[model samples]
Target: MKDTNHPLPVIVEQAELTLAGLQTTMSLAHNTTMQLWQTFGPLKKSIHNKSNGGSYSVQCYADNFMSIPFTPETKFVKWAAVAVFNEDDIPKELEVLKIPKGKWAVFSYKGTISDFGKFAQYVYQEWLPSSGYQLDHRPHYEFMASDYLGPNHPDAQEEVWIPIV
Candidate 1:
């Protein structure tokens, strides 16, 4: 079996992004992102201005989320979205999100989505510590496309994008 781990990131100046999709309040302690996506996937066709064929999984941490004893209700904003040209095509119940241009460190992730915890640990604990870049205030997101079969697919692929200063 292929080892699941995170390698170094490719630094880049990400362009501003405009997106529209479902939004909810959740915590990583009891992640319900997949459930959110399950609801969003079938309705994706309703979005008429898709800028790309891929989707983005975005997380905006709560201000106090880093506090000790983060719990299931820590409250973070989760988005299962896709890039769009504008909000004109968005569904009535969906929300719009705008990500400003910023510097980011993007890592290529492979293997099942369940391995993300370990992969994230490697990125935040091992890689970030020596990467000379600190986390930025923007949301962290993943760009999934081509090889993205499903969350549990052994050969799934995605780009983990971490905002950096």
Candidate 2:
């Protein structure tokens, strides 16, 4: 059944990445998060704060990202992710990915981490289902690139990339 009320975004099929480096694993609910916020506060966002319990199996460095299954409904406390890209024709210091070729659903979001989750909800709840592509049970992640001068920069841009089949 086509959902006339929900509109889907254009889906791009490309195998640009295969793995990603998750520099940090954090949840806003935990008290230990202060340390992380102090260090990487510039790039951070609030994901769904679920009391039902959720855990993310994330790994740093795309090269070491092993394929694993994950539950979609299990909510996670979101955080801003910054991409470590290839510089000077060479991979960046956090070089950790070698994508053999896979599908990706890319979306762009601007501003602070405050509205990050809302953007995600727009994708997962609204975009994915209407687009006709099912979610790939893999380690999905976001890409942090663009003019991010620091946490204070309001124009900071981010690319949210989810692995798709």
* Clashes per candidate (backbone, < 3 Å): 0, 10
lDDT of each: 0.84, 0.44
Worst 10 residues of 2 by lDDT: 47-56
Give the true-structure RMSD of model 1. 3.1
Q: Name model 2 segments beyond 4 Å from true.
A: 1-10, 14-24, 31-100
Determine which window of 10 residues in candidate 1 has minimal summed lDDT: 63-72
Q: Would you give me the overall lDDT of model 1?
A: 0.84
Which lDDT value does model 2 have at 117?
Answer: 56
lDDT of 1 by residue, 6-100 (tens): 46678999889998889888876777888999999888888889999999999987554334544555778899999999879588878899998
Over the stretch 33-137, how does candidate 2's per-residue lDDT look in tens digits? 345435434322222221112212232223222233224332343332232233223223222344434676766656666666566667776777667677664
Instruction: Give the C-alpha lDDT of model 2.
Output: 0.44
